[model samples]
Structure formats: C-alpha cells, structure tokens
Target: MSAPPVHDPPAAGVVRLPHTGLQVPDARLRVVRCRPHYVNRWEYRALLVRGEQRIGHIRGPLPDVAEPGPAGVAGGGPVVSFHPRGRAFTEAELEDFAAACRLDGQGLSSARVLTLLVDEYRIEQMVRGCARRGGVMARCCGEGWVHYIPLRAYPRSAGQCAAALAHLERASGVGGPWRIWDGQQWSPLSVGSGPDTSPGCA
Candidate 1:
C-alpha cells in the first residue's frame, strides 16, 4: 500500500521558533570592528560604535611583566610596562573630528566623556573632583562620535581602568549640545553650548 502524503505548515507571516540552526534577522546581528594601535599587545586606539550611533573609543598600552621568582621575590628580567601616551580629544576637538566625518551640526545632549588609562590614581582624583562639583571630565580618545563609559568607579592607582561614568552622568545633567572629537575634526553632538545655559567651549 502507498503511504499518506505529509503536509507542511503555512509559511505566510508565521513566527518561527528559535534554534541553533535558525537564521536571525540582519538587524539583530551585532557586528564589531576594532582599530588597534599596536600589535602583539593590547594597544588599541580606535573608535567603537554600535549601528549608526557612536559608543566610544578604546586606547591602551597594556603592561607586559614577568612572574615572580621562587621565593616570591622580584625577578631579574626587565620590567616591561606598556605605556602608550595619547591624549583624549576634548569636546571641541570632537566637533572638528565630526566635521571631517561629514557629520557637522550634529548635537550630543547629556553625554559623558571617558578615558581608559593605566593610571588609576590620577583618574580617581579627577573623578572625585568631578563628583564633588557635579562636573564631568572630558578626554579625547580619537576622532569619532563614539565615546566610552567605564563600568566601575575609578581605580586607586595610576594606569588603572578608570571609569568615566561620572563625567558622562554630569554631562547629561548639565544639558549640552556638547562637543566631541572625531579623530580628524571636531563637531557638536547635540545643541551648541551657548553662553546663556550651555557649557562653554573648552
């Protein structure tokens, strides 16, 4: 005897279940690109963004140190510390960078500026000052709209991963068509910081 034919479900506007083999929508896929400053080390000085929105930049010169000796003492090998020196672009610088990117006249409101450095102590001091006065520390990472916010508080030493979260928080509170650097030029992110009630140019 012949077997019965099987019928498949309708395919029009039907929601499909998610599985390992399933394909997701292109909009849902996250793509990450890196612009490293150096090789063999974590010296990355590049802009980070999500979709069309700018997130921040990552610049670092990670240290390369050896392990301790048998007695838990310092070793004889040379102490290698990766200290890449590069200034984070300021709001004005960012405005120029953005202009170069052809994104002139764009504005950023209530945004924070973050800088990831090896010096934790310095960052801590700065953060403390900003916290007290309710101001933000603006650093130039590169020439781009993307900026970063540290997930944690500033460290207690220099060259530590100091979070620029407080700065961002303050920027948002003060109201800005704040300026930012886009590597090659500077541009505004929100509205222009005017003399009436905006943070003046830096």
Candidate 2:
C-alpha cells in the first residue's frame, strides 16, 4: 500500500514563537490597534499583539515638509531649516531612560507602563531594521546631514522587558481598555473583562 499523503495542519489564528530570531508572524493572526498623535506633525502609532500579549508597536516620525526654494534664488541661503529640532532616543539612551523610569519610585499608571514598553520596543526594532539595511542617512535642516551608524541593535531593553512583565501581571486584574489621567485624560487601548475595572485599579 502507498504511504498516506502528507497534509499540513490548518492555519492557527494566533501563534507564539521564541523571540530569538528576526521572524515576524502574519499580521492577520494578530490583534492590532492604531492611534493618532500630534496631528500637526502627522504621527501615527500602532500596537501589535498575538492573543492577549503585546508583540510590538510602530512609530513613524514626521516627514520633511520644506518647499522647494524660490526660482532664481542663488545658493538658497544654506537651507537653514531642513532638519527639525527634537532628537529621537538612541538605543543606549532609551535603555537608560527605561532604567531610570524603573528606579525613580514614581508610580506608573498601567496604561502609561504599557505605552512606554510599546514605544521603546518599537524604536529598538526600527533601529535594528535600519542596521540590517546596511545603513541610513539622516538629513537635518536641509543643510545638516549625518549617517546613523549602528553598533548594536536590540528588540527589548532590560527595563522594557521588566516593565512589560509587570504590566502584564497588573493587567490580569484590570478589565478592558480604559482611560488614564496624568493630569489629563488619555485615550483607551485594549479591552478585557477582569477583576479590576475602575480608574487606576491596576
């Protein structure tokens, strides 16, 4: 008799894998939430998840918006404003920031903790992507230019890893996505039915 034909299993809605490689699972198998921040600068952020665990996030900085110089304008006065102010955190800087946040003894609302981990991991992933693509050129103020040379890349910092686990522990108690206030109301993210559902319950 002939051997039975081999058959692949049906696709799973969600899958978990070891976090040691550069593999990203299919988007359709994950829960994703997108939020907008800074309308004037056009910043959009997204959170990614598999099952109930957050996997990562995406953050894109504002793109350049300088108009072409006027016709017949010689030299263009050195393109003084091509590069905008405000620097994104370097990998080392982000690591340090996360560490500081951990040690500061300042209590973080559950949402804030989640947001922090999401943003930091996302930034680290971007740095790794840039590095894998050889290198990237960064332009500033139209006149200033620099190349971002990556010495190392990481998916998660020590502080971020700790914070994520901590948030998850607390998250188990909170029910559903809800608002948090740091002197002001913050938008909700993720929803669940759990023990603690009140403000700052986690």
Candidate 3:
C-alpha cells in the first residue's frame, strides 16, 4: 500500500514538530521554584509577566509535553516552556530567565530556544507545499523576490552567514524580510559596523 499522506493521522508515538512563530511581547519572567535534575540543569516553575501583571506560567524541562518520564516529569534537557502562541525564546530573554533564578554562568547559557533545524535533506521534507523542489524557498521584505537556494549556499559561521544574508537583502532591495518555512520570523539581517572578531555563540 502507498504510504499515508503527510497530514494523515500519525501513528502512535509519532510527534508533530513545532515552529517558532514570534517572541513574547513585553515579556517579564521570574522563576518561582526550581527542582534540580542534572548538573547545571533544573526543572522550573516560572511566571510569565507583562508590565506588572502576571500573564502565564512557564513550567518546564521543555520535553514534558512530548515525552514525560515517570510521574509526568520530563527527562533532562534545557529549561524551556514556550508561550501558547508557539513563540521561541531569544538569548536575551533566556538570560533574563536565568537571572531571576540566580543561575550560575553554566546554567545561564542552558536555556533552550525553540527553532526548526534546517538541513539539505530536511529542507525537502519541510517545504513540501512549495511549487519548487530541491532547494529551500525564501521570501524577504514582502518584495516579489521569492526564490529557492540550497542550504550549502548559506555559510555556517554566524559572521559569514550574517554578511551573506545582508548582501542578499541589499541585492534584492528588500528591507527586513522573514523567509518562508525557516521558523525564523526575525527581521532583515545585518551585522555590526566593526569587524565581528568574537567567536559566535558557544
């Protein structure tokens, strides 16, 4: 028999992937409680806040919704609990979370951000609905410049990658564009004025 369609009901134990839709607006957070599991890692209960109002709770090992261990606790990983809107955490936001919890430097960098992993092969599976095939499709600044480029065309280093994206934006005359299917909705890419000598995020 032919395999089931992509949208067909998933078999037992199958997982649906998530996307990074947006950043939490005016976000403020505080860790109310924490339970340590592994070194530099903890399961936490936090409050998501906006201005002076408490908005929601962020309870996590991030994997609890996907694979909970005994008693509904999740196995070890970075501490993360996204908002209901499928938004991802930013580095600055994660730092804020870590600060409120008084986490050491090691723990500070362990906060997880939700994002889609894109590779040459995975790009094929991800961009299924696009008329194009093989390479990934991208659109920036709402300009009519929609096209597909292979993953190899993109540089791996942050400095190089940012430069390439900046060049692409200038060439296409699009300001601050969000590419399709990448799960990254951030604005147009640009590097700082000086040489980016520092090593990218560790």
Best by TM-score: 2
Query: Which 10-residue span in candidate 2 carries the lowest summed lDDT?
Result: 14-23
Q: What is the TM-score of each candidate against the true structure?
A: 0.17, 0.24, 0.22
**lDDT of each residue in 1-202, candidate 2, tens digit only:** 0111223332333221111111122322221555556756654456645456554554433224323443111144321111111343233432332222320123322223333334334434544466576532111111222112222222135564344334533644433232211112122222332232222211
Best by lDDT: 3
The better-scoring model by lDDT among 1 and 2 is 2
Whole-model lDDT values for every prediction: 0.30, 0.31, 0.34
Candidate 3, 100: how far from true, in Å?
42
Pairs clashing within candidate 2 = 82-141, 82-142, 83-140, 83-141, 83-142, 176-192, 177-191
**1 against 3, candidate with superior TM-score:** 3
Ranking by TM-score: 2, 3, 1
Enumerate clash totals for all models, in the order shown. 44, 7, 2
Looking at model 3, the pairs that clash are 141-177, 176-188
In model 2, which regions exceed 4 Å deviation? Answer: 1-43, 50-105, 135-202
The alpha-carbon RMSD values of the candidates against the true structure, listed in the order shown, are 22.4, 22.8, 18.5
